[model samples]
Target: MPKMKSHSGTKKRFRRTGTGKLMRGKAFKSHILTKKSTKRKRGFRQETVISNADKRVVSTRLAGR
Candidate 1:
């Protein structure tokens, strides 16, 4: 049987933590920073766990990893 390949885009966007949870970057911090508050911008710097609904899908894409 051929080896299963992981999703390239998913691998770049998500990472597994020490405990195995998938961590992803918060969105909306990439452009038009002038209108966003400092607090909101600061929050975007932290990585957040994928939601329960999306966990299965994301993990499957990352199965080969």
Candidate 2:
């Protein structure tokens, strides 16, 4: 059987943690920085784990990652 092609965009935007959870960057920090507070911007710097409900779909595209 041929190898499956992982989603290129997903591969770049998300990653699987050592524990197998889907890790992705937080949103709302990329624009309008002047209106956002320092604390809020700091929070966006950290990666967030994907919610359980969305795990199945993400896992499929990230298979073999």
Candidate 3:
């Protein structure tokens, strides 16, 4: 059987942590930085775990990893 392919976009956007939880980047940090507060921008630098609602879908997409 052929190998299953990973979702390229999901692979780039999500990552597995040491304990296996999925981590993802914060949105809204990629544009219009001039209007955003420094604290808000700083907050975006941290990675967040995927929500329980989306965790299953994301894990399937990331399965090939």
Candidate 4:
């Protein structure tokens, strides 16, 4: 059987946690941040787990990793 390739885009955007959850970065921090408060911007620095609804789909894309 042929080897399954992980989704390149998803692979770059998400990471596997120690417990196997998918960790991803928050959005809206890349552009025009002058109006956004420092507190909100700081929150974006931390990683977040993917939603339960998307877990299965993302896991499949992540393959072995």
Candidate number with the higher lDDT (1 or 4): 1
In the range 1-65, model 2's lDDT, one tens digit per residue, is: 78888988889989987888799999898889999999989999999998899898889888844
Between candidates 2 and 3, the one scoring higher on lDDT is: 3
- Which residue pairs does candidate 4 place in steric collision? none
Q: Candidate 1 deviates by what RMSD?
A: 1.4
Ten contiguous residues with the weakest lDDT in model 2: 56-65
lDDT of 3 by residue, 1-65 (tens): 78888899999999999899999999999988999999999999999998999999999888964
Error of 3 at 29 (Å): 0.6
Model 1: per-residue lDDT, tens digit, 1-65? 89999999999999999999999999999999999999999999999999999999899999974
Best by TM-score: 1
Residue 24 alpha-carbon offset, candidate 4, angstroms: 0.6
* Ranking 2 against 3 by TM-score, winner: 3
Candidate 2 stretches with Cα past 4 Å from truth are: none
Candidate 3, residue 3: lDDT? 87
Question: How much lDDT does candidate 3 score?
Answer: 0.94
lDDT per residue (tens digit) for residues 1-65 in model 4: 77888999988999998887899999999999999999999999999999999999998888944
Candidate closest to the true structure, highest lDDT:
1
Local distance difference test, candidate 2: 0.88
For candidate 1, what is the total of clashing residue pairs?
A: 0
